[model samples]
Target: MKQEKGAEGFSENYWLENYADVDDMDGMYNARDHAHYLKAVFALDQIAIRSIADFGFGPGHLFSAALDTFKPYRSLGLEPSASAFIKAQTVLKRYQPQLLQTDLASWCRDSSQHKRFDLGICTSVLQYLNDQELAAVIPTLALRVKYLYLTVPTAAEQQRFVEEYQFVDQYAYSRTRQQYRELLSPHFTVVSSRLLESKQFYNDQTSDFTEDLFRF
Candidate 1:
């Protein structure tokens, strides 16, 4: 494993145990809803995607959806937590035989075995990392993928979550659309961006906004 700032600060089991409890985890601030993401995949021409990668692929929801819909040539999932990776592995068994588990920064550095991808998706993940970590990770992700799909929290909502959730460093940072472009422009062309008024129907009365989706 490549060394990282406080790389050993948090244990993977802790995250898995905590995330297993939905109430303890940040639920309201989820990424694009499963159904809507599926719609986005269906609209894409099947032939366009050959290989795909999902960074911080939580619970394998997006990964499963991609495999089910696109049937891409290959799908790779990268996760930091052991517990999350275990669950993701169980859910993504159809592709498990080919799955690779490693830290994104370290993996990207090793070009010999780990190669760049055709498409990369990071949903509801980047908003959780601080500016420094994002700076380190996003650029590498950009270099590794020809196309990238990212989901981020709305400015106002992210602020609210940071205050309400009382997260120390992670989830306290948010970036604007322009900032995203600036970060990725050096490595990729901004293909498109759309503000999705993500509606989370939690028993109808309890609905919330996720964020915008930036496709590069």
Candidate 2:
């Protein structure tokens, strides 16, 4: 088996040197934002989130929130950063979720170990992948879960970051929302701007979504 890679700049060295700087990826440390994300998922109340799979959960902060809200019996998370993975172990100890120290590609390849999951969350993580990897994972993720909540920085956001260099994480790419949606639309229906309903499993008849056009 090939060795898995840790986060780009999140090795144990970073934790020891800059322990106080909590914003490891620019502006990715906000609990309120997480609450907002869960609020949308909860409102969907359309689907029961019994099982969750978070591809890159960082230190498991958002994953912990999901565990609390859904109270799912089965949960799994993958965080490549050694320090983040160690921190996640403690943060998610109560839930006892199965955590992995691997990247999304590796996990996607070996994900048949468990059956399909109810919800999949991959926030701000996909922008870090290259084009081919991103394309490969989209269909894989579509097949693995019933619902998905994803967030990626589009080309417009990248341009904004270029003008104002605050939110620029040097390790990430600036793929367009249309590019991502084109890839995801093949397997999942747009639930909202950042949400998706899998075509393979979601069979809602009463939702007020014609989906003639999707929002950003």
Candidate 3:
């Protein structure tokens, strides 16, 4: 069955067809990767973070691992893929984090929910967004959270994998590291930056990744 694509060209149906099972989601970070993520989460000491949000939280692995490191009063995981959301519900049931099956822009546009988060995490997901979506989502994220942890595949990294990897029915755009910094500089203060290597989150391969900490 063909999967439905969102307005921004993200295909929830495609992900469901390929990775309906939680085990099939290799994008979820491994134990070592989770440790690295936790270290960044705890680095923000300006405020005691009581609430957190995870954009594009596929299969809830990062969120689940986070529960062991820190307990926030409220946690929200926003995922566009319905199948991934379903798997997250079961896998993350113990943490009780609120899971939403919608893209970030739609969630941000809701006038009813004025809730804001202390920290937001977006890992291994930004490369899938096109320019227009990035323009809308980045500002919204800045407005929604005090801080953000964003991870993306750099242009150099994307180039290395272009031959063997591609998203099904989604447009994955790559930008130079400088371009990304310029894109975010107007909306956030860069606090830290680092590079990470990971096994393919969607395919059976490996990739170089970059993570940045930003204060909104």
TM-score of each: 0.64, 0.79, 0.72
Q: Taking the tens digit of each residue's C-alpha lDDT, what string does model 1 give over 66-132? A: 6665677776887765666777787788765255556656555666745656667776666556566
Off by over 4 Å in 2: 1-46, 165-167, 203-216
What overall lDDT goes with each candidate model?
0.56, 0.71, 0.63
Model 1: lowest-lDDT 10 consecutive positions: 195-204
Q: lDDT tens digits, residues 1-216, model 3?
A: 122334343455556544555453444537336535555645543335578788888767777766545688899888887667787788779889888888877777777767888668787777766677788877777777766767787778766655555533234565898988777766666544532111111111221112223322
Per-prediction RMSD in angstroms?
Answer: 9.7, 4.5, 9.0
lDDT of 2 by residue, 154-212 (tens): 88987786687544455566677788778877888877766787777654564334454
lDDT of 3 at 128: 68
Off by over 4 Å in 1: 1-47, 128-133, 162-178, 194-216
Question: What is the Å distance of residue 31 in model 1 from its true position?
Answer: 8.7
Give the candidate number with the greatest lDDT: 2
Report residue 40 deviation for candidate 3 (angstroms). 6.3
